[model samples]
Every structure is written in C-alpha cells, then in structure tokens.
Target: VVKWNIDKAVKGDPDYIVDRINVHYNIGHLQAVGGDSTRPAGDYLLALNKLSKDQYLPVGPDLPENQEIIDISGEQMKMLASFPTPPEPHDAT
Candidate 1:
C-alpha cells in the first residue's frame, strides 16, 4: 500500500524523493556530517531495493502472494499532486 506508492515515488525521482525523505525522516546531524552527504539516499534506495524483491521479509508471517495491492486514495493522491513540482530549467540558447 503505502510502501508501493513510496517505491513508485522514489523510482520516479530519486533525488527529490531522497531529499524530502532525508529531511522528513531526519537522520540528523551525525549522519549528515560528511563530504558524501548522499549516503542517506543510497541507504534508502538499498533498503527499498531489498524490500521490492521480497528478499528481506518482515519479522512475522509472509505477506500475501499477490503482495499488497495499492489503490491511491483520493486524499493521498491529491496530497501527492499538491507537492510543488521541481522548477524548470531556464533556456540558455
């Protein structure tokens, strides 16, 4: 459900998704202190990739065979749509 949508959003725009998730998830100052700050993004992608394949199952019983079928609720879809789109690049020609 939520996980699938998040996966889609992450795949759609890794940079934007990572930035927002990092800020929202708040890995904090210790994790952010480094020249290679995109580690958080990398870690997130790694985790998502693992989950997507069912390689890393949850702690309890296995989920359904079909996986979770997710329909974007009207409110959730609207919220996602409301997020401001990335700014367009200026024509330099």
Candidate 2:
C-alpha cells in the first residue's frame, strides 16, 4: 500500500510519497470504510487480496484469499493485521 503525502503533492513537491507497505499478492479490491458515503471514513481500509501466497500458512495446495486490515487514522498508513478468508480467490464483495 502506498500512502502519498497529499500535503506535499499539493505544494508541487516532486516526491510526494511518504509511506509504503507491502500487502498480500494480487490485490483485488481496496475498500475504505464508509468510502461510498458522503461522510468521512478516513480511519480504516481493507486490502482484499486475490492471492494469499506466503502471507499465511497453507492448508493444502491452494492458499486462501485474505483481507488485510490497514490503519489509516495516522499520518502514515499502518498495516495493523490480516486474516485468511474462505477458499474464494476473489471475493471482494
């Protein structure tokens, strides 16, 4: 996940990137809390990955998909935690 320092971007800074974090393989969806609404939901984000890969322990030949929870309530986005989802490879909904 890349968190751009928009404060710097607005000021025409060439390097506006402030933070970057690794997520699971092949991200399918990136949903922000209350992002569909008009209200502010700037607290959390969900990285719906299409593949878990080495992010979690494998049960069989297939690795389960995952939802990586990211904390966006601070100056820098932090990967708080993650959990393995069902066998569905791309269940963003």
Give each prediction's root-mean-square deviation over alpha carbons. Answer: 18.1, 3.1
Best-matching candidate per TM-score: 2
Write down the TM-score for model 2. 0.71
How close is every model to the real structure, measured as TM-score? Answer: 0.14, 0.71
lDDT of 2 at 73: 85
State the lDDT of candidate 1 residue by residue for 1-93, as single tens digits.
122347657578643332222112211112111225543331111111112223233544542111111123333311121111112211111
Deviation (Å) of 79 in candidate 2: 1.4
Q: All candidates' lDDT scores? A: 0.23, 0.79
Span of ten consecutive residues with least summed lDDT in model 1 = 42-51
Candidate 2 deviant stretches above 4 angstroms: 53-63, 87-93
Candidate 1 has an lDDT of: 0.23
| Candidate 2 lowest-lDDT run of ten | 84-93
